[model samples]
Target: MEKRIVTVQYNYDVAIVGSGVAGLFGACHMDPSLKVLVIAKREPDLTNTSLAQGGIAAVLDTVNDNQEDHIRDTMIAGGYENNPDAVRLLVSRGPADVRELMELGAVFDRNPDGSLNYTLEGGHCRPRIVHHKDSTGSEVQRALLAYVRTLPNVTIWEDSLVALLKKDTCFHLDVIQEHTDLIRHVNARVCLLATGGIGRVYEYTTNSKIATGDGIAFAYRLGARIKNLHYIQFHPTGFANKKDRETFLISESVRGEGGYLLNAEKKRFMQNYDPRQELAPRDVVSHFEMVETKRQNSNDLWLDISYKPADFIRQRFP
Candidate 1:
């Protein structure tokens, strides 16, 4: 394979900022004849989606599941504060998006009989999580990257940071390339900001370093409508270290696979908090974990996957 050289000048029909799952998907969705430029602050593979462990939620198996149930669960998990139209759209379109991924050679886990394997997650009443063992995000990213790389019209700029978006009639991006230490102006008819998550702004997060709210910041600076700035999702088990930076996520799939959250006293406390117990929404679980940790006067809580077979853990996780 011939490696494409990183350059400082370019124009495209579509300019996508941040080469995460969203950006890659956006490029993949464009007409093959349309020129597309994808920009990433680091290597295209190092975005926050690459760090994600949990699977994307969708109601794929309608024979056993329904979209209404999925929608209801989402609404409840979102504290009944979610927009009905948006939620409906998401639930309706998710299956097709997932199908698109499948057609692109993304291998989701399957049952013994050779159907898609589904797993339950916090807040979901049905097993709607389509995953590749415990590393669904990585699998999805790998597949998307592979598909994107084969497109002649799609160009990827690794280690290129978008400094600002200059808009007059259209969006012109000022990008700084790291290796050459040169800034370049890129003009495009359409610019999509697909940068994922603002978790980096917080002290502890499962998000990658590139998830610094850059997309949101850029959009805000450009006077775009921004919603849900205050809403943040905190996962319960991020691998903690003395450095207090870049916490590795212990995926929620572990809990789905029968991992138990225990305090210093080795007691299962989630049952006291909610009927769903360990399988509650992330916000609910994180909140309960924090409250218990405070009450127990301990900063660290243990997620015990020891009860599960070691071979299963190694096969699924490693």
Candidate 2:
């Protein structure tokens, strides 16, 4: 742990302590008159948002999908542990948010008729995921970042890390630049810590390198009543590489689009686990993968989509 010695102090109406989609989007939404500072530990683009390959899940097609169905599927996928209110809100308001993203210049795949191309992913009863091919998160972050930069009140500080956070009459943060010993004290009326997950703590994860749970730790130390720390989603398909701590995710859309998961003998085994098989919720699929590993006495597994036409696969994922 480093000592918090504040050398300089600055004030802002709002301070956002991560430059992911949440931080950027929030900055874009804030009142234009308020001074806002966004602190990024690394380059603003290097975040879990940039690494997300799966698309946003929303009930965009009301005729084919409804909020009730979306909520039910979300509850079932979360094993009913998810907050019902939050789930409902997400299903109801999510489509509008997706539309807003489009208005902000974040493009998604569109059908020939010009409507958004909604695709299916695991745990979804319908094809409600609107995306920019496979790199939806990057497109979202790009749009948000561009829009936020245009906001005169918002200041983005890249390569800066928030080392300490303490709240007195307002929130105080100790921000230190990367590869530098100087710490600058920053005070804000509102501090939003949008730092991402704890995946780096795991031996192997598809999460970005910055997903080390910094915001959660800061909140915990400040006596924030954190919930669902034990509830972690394990992605089922990662490139089988033991050498790197960061593993490339084989996106859920792969399985959603008729890809097959195979055992060591190249035999499909998901049929033995669940009726939905590859389309099962991530946790379910991950659990059965481990079970299959134990039973087969090997960790060897494969996701095969070679049977699909090359042109179709390229167009779909490109």
Candidate 3:
């Protein structure tokens, strides 16, 4: 028989699982009086959020872009299958969120005149992506983590995995510390699962190792109806490095910023499938890649941006 070490159960007003952008951001907005507990399955910084390279898209400039345009673009990208009300709300409220991120000390790239330097990405008609060079998500996470740490009412525990969850009058959680294998019980009036995507389940993916769908699994067990499991979209461009299971993602912004996609023959083939070519939505581009691969009988593809000036490339990507 094994001797189990169990700690006393602690209570919190809100228990947020996973330290990705969603978790950290939610923690930042919690009322200071409410005791908040954030649990991370690994080091807080190592999350899918940190792996995001492309900038967030929002209609920050109303002069050239508007919320309706943003909503339309999103709907088109989603193949018109998205909820209209949700898209409207997101597009309408997104600029304020971006402004709030800036208020929280997340610095994005700016123009020489001091306005936000917005860039373009695949599936968008406007240049509305505000980023910190190319690592927008990391910058956002860093700012949120820093702000969350300053809140005395909030606590962050890394390397703590939520093994089991039960709900009664309140929510109960069984947490296992990865380092010491110590078990601890936690109770929270509210439980928010911010666990990210289910990418690691695939043979090859660009998603972070922590994206194992833990939150989705927990939600399903809690009687939440799961749908659209088959809606997984493959990225059109990833570095074909056979060495690692996780291929490096070539950001869609690359194509948005004039990068070209070439097939095995070192010639562009996207024109044959879609007029938008490289700028097509991810699913469309990914589908055509497969079709072109079969036609060419080779998986050799290239994303070329070397034609741009060295200084411009460095300024945009770095």
lDDT of 2 by residue, 30-135 (tens): 9988999999989999999998887999987888888899999999999999999999988888988988988998999999999988888999988988889889
The TM-score-based order of candidates, best leading, equals 3, 2, 1
Best by TM-score: 3
| Candidate 1 wrong stretches, greater than 4 Å | 1-9
Error of 3 at 26 (Å): 0.7
TM-score of 1: 0.95
TM-scores of all models?
0.95, 0.97, 0.97
Local distance difference test scores for all models = 0.89, 0.90, 0.90
- The Cα error of candidate 2 at residue 257, in Å, is 0.7
Comparing 1 with 2 on lDDT, the higher-scoring candidate is: 2
The reply for model 2, stretches above 4 Å from the true place, is: 1-6
Model 3, position 279, has a per-residue lDDT of 91
